[model samples]
Target chain A: MKKLINNPSDVVNEQLLGLAAAHPELHLSLAPRYVCRKDIPQGKVAVVSGGGSGHDPLHCGYVGFGMLDGACPGEIFTSPTPDQMYECAKHVDRGAGVLFIVKNYTGDVLNFETSAELCKMDGIQVQCILIDDDVAVKGGGHTSGRRGVGLTVLAEKIVGAAAQAGYSLGACADLCRRINQNGRSMGVALSSCIIPEAGETTFLLDNDEIELGIGIHGEQGVERRCMASVDILVELMVEHIFSDPEYVRVAREMNSASGEWEDVQLVSTPFSRGESFIVLVNGMGGTPPGELYGVYRKFAELCDEKGVSIKRNLVGTYISSLEMQGCSITMLRADDEMVRLWDARAVTPGLCFPSCDDVTSCGTSNAD
Target chain B: MLTKKNVLIWFEKSADAMAEHKQELHLLDAAIGDGDHGINMNRGFGKLALELPVMGAMTLQEIFKHAGMVLLSTVGGASGPLYGTLFLKGAATVGTSEALDASAVLTFFDAGVEGLVARGRTEENDKTMYDVWAPVLREYELCLEAEMEFVEILAACVCAAEVGMKATIPMLARKGRASYLGERSIGHQDPGATSSYYLINALYESIRE
Candidate 1:
């Protein structure tokens, strides 16, 4: 309610306008709201992902040289409609094809599925890779299964790099699926975020309480308990992620041959000892960078004690939940290929890796 | 006793009802879900209202199809596709018809409910809009069998919808965002079910007017 905005209804439009103004490399469209990279490679497979607006630097920030080719942002905490995705894909798709990186919420899933159907009807080859890497929920209970969290940022980068390397649409989708299966994330929120239109926080917590395993939409977490120190919180989240059971669920994938959705069974492999990991300690908007490093420091110590090697690490506010004060930890079991892909240079408004050309002069700009 | 003009008027009344109860629906949704059902429904219906002028010139099936497209494109949540599919499938049942009677109305509701079930994959007692829609369809069938007047049958259906909507208050949600709350989801009226009751009540009001 106390945020800086002209009007509640114009929040998304005005914010998108600001994004376009700040980032010259991105193009914004109004009739159907979507952000696309201005200089998309001529024939490479296009990667597109999007969700609600509060999770900024997510679907849109990842749109650049080596990330998503386009993103379709919906209203606050609402999934984007099929028209946005369909039109964005049409605009971005070259001769090769377009890949949709969808999160695993019911509205998102249904809307993207409809978009894929629409694209296919127009003779564009579309493949969808769903990310559901949050290990908070045990299974696909009443609501859709595990919600996509921090792992989405990593998926966009890795899959975007693969697409940049001229991988086929199928190959990019396959790699995205593998990344989704190999990663796990858990989060805890100190407080709830206020949706702009609602003009109130979604939920309330006491000063000494924290909600554990929260989705990004400001939904109530799975469990609430007395607040703990940063070290203890990180340890708790790490333990949950490491000890979570192998998750198996039914997912829908588009069959390009038949142009229909086919049910595909997906399994998330459990974390094991002696595996190398790409650890991401992400802030949920309100948390400071120094605190995130504190989280990373404790998380790294716990991983070392558990015999898991940290192959690579990123600590920042890459994915957010409005201005909610919280952080999430994502761990991807990294193989040689994943490591290489993760290391690939990328330049986007949200994430920028120092290129070989700039490293000599810039001396490593702080990406966070 | 139902004409294409009546169907159009029903849609207009439904939109007005959604606008009137938008805040009430949001309050109900706030208790368990993301709390935007009212806003989403109002936006969808508002868009449909804009197209009403064009829709008035079309066949009944065409009007329903156009309304479904508008809802699908404008509404941004689960209700978008659920309600969109309802209208689309209902449109298929009355292709190019200028008017319909009690049996046709029954077929329309049956197809719409079937489409909702297919899209949402929800069973009975999931505490969704389906709770109201399924019962209203059943009551409509019963009223028809008893040879009631058209307006009387619609009134009976609206009453069943109201009863079904209130019945969701004590039921645990097994689908959509409300399901995330587990046991806490009980004791709150299902927002989607409430809007569905408004829609049915609007239909009754339209015919009586």
Candidate 2:
């Protein structure tokens, strides 16, 4: 109930104002909450992505070089109304077509579609890419589909970089598809979050409780158990994600399919293997880096045990819940060309590729 | 048969019931939900009150249309869409006539249930609004099949709704936020289904009076 803020109701708007002030290089529409790069190229496709406001350093933080062209911010944990998204699309449109990057939530998908209609009315070429990377919720039903979480941030980064590098609009979109196909995320929550406006925790769990396979919005996880060791938690998550036959099958297929991959250890400027990938150990909210890194350590150990090579490893609070204590792990298999592109230099507040000297290869081999 | 006065009466009754249990509902939801069911429902129907007076001699559809708009705009959660769609679809079936006879009322209820299903993707055991609505809809059809008097039919549907609502207490949630609780959701009555029962009870009291 008690926190630092001018008003609970004005949180989103105030945060948006602060974000714009802090990141002067990013362009934000006064209304409709679109955050894009300051300068959008003419005749180049613009990528528009959005959702509710709680998950920071996402949707908006990624609105810089090599990421989203624009983002629409809605109320906390609530999908932006169709009106907001529609206006954002209209505002972010350059001569080139615009693609809507939407999460898989029903309301989000529907509202984005509504905005797409408005885009179409203006004769704007619009396509939609839905990110459904969470493995928590059972999928293939009329609903209860997987949620879009960490992978969304990855998609914006990779695809945004591709688009900026002069890939055709379709090619940029194809990169997005490849990212989604190769990526999967799963999370667990240690505690609940207090929504500022509501002045109460969204959900309550006992001191010994932990929720496995949780979503970013403080939604309950698929399973709850007594708090376990960090190693145990990572084991469960890694087992659930890696145990999927499809994930391995897909990785093997992508490994062979992405023929033009560069070997990082072999050469400084390797050609495209198109097989580089990323693993993000995302923090839900209240989790501290020390704790997050503790989990990441376990993740690295597991990947080593499994022989699943990581193209690049990113661990931090990239996507989050509303100050909830938890973390999600996402794995994205990249082709060698993709690995090259991932290595491509880009600058954003949240995402940064350190100098080559700063980076170190963790796994023993590409197979491992 | 519900005259305009009766429709207004239903809104008043539901509002009263919601006010009485608002805190309890909030508490129940706080356990495994976002903890705003009471406030959200209250805000939604509270707006329904102001519009009803000005909507003089409005038909069931018109009254429901107004309610739907209020719910959609004020509730601001999963309930917003579920309840809003219910009223919106209900309004689609009944026009702006000044009164609703028993059969017309049943038709509206049927439409509302359909809308709830379509919007929420909830099924019989999902521990949601559908829990209250499913049995009531079935009883309503049963009453019509038996050719019961309109009064009897209304009473039967309301009773069935109340039972269904109470039955949610022991049910494990399988939809929406509650489903995340898994087995932990077993003992708590679904907050959404509880409110839905209040709605049906309100309607029964108004029409009967």
Which candidate comes out best when scored by DockQ?
A: 1
Which one is best on TM-score? 1
Runs of candidate 1 exceeding 4 Å displacement:
A354-368, B142-149
lDDT of 2 at A163: 73
* Candidate 2 C-alpha lDDT tens digits along A1-368: 76777888899888888888987888777554567777777767888888878898888877766677888887788766555666666766776777778876655664565556556667766776667777776532323456789999878877877777777666775677667767778899998887788788877889999999888887755688999999999999987776543421111001112322112210012112333448889999789999999998999887877766777877788888878998999888767767667766556666655332323321124341
lDDT (tens digit, per residue) of candidate 2 on B21-58: 89887887777575768877787677777677776666
Q: List the residue pairs that clash in candidate 1.
A: none
RMSD of 1: 2.7
- State the lDDT of candidate 1 residue by residue for B1-209, as single tens digits: 77878878888998999999999999998787877898999999988888889988888888888888888889888888888888888988997678889999899889988978877778889999999998898899989999999999999988899899999999998888888777889999999999999989988988998
Task: Provide DockQ values for all models, in the order shown.
Answer: 0.59, 0.12
Worst 10 residues of 1 chain B by lDDT: B1-10
**Candidate 2 residue spans exceeding 4 A from truth:** A23-52, A64-66, A69-132, A135-147, A159-178, A188-193, A197-240, A245-276, A286-305, A324-326, A336-368, B1-16, B50-66, B94-101, B144-152
Candidate 2 residue B131 C-alpha distance from true site, Å? 2.5
Query: Each candidate's TM vs. the true structure?
Result: 0.93, 0.73
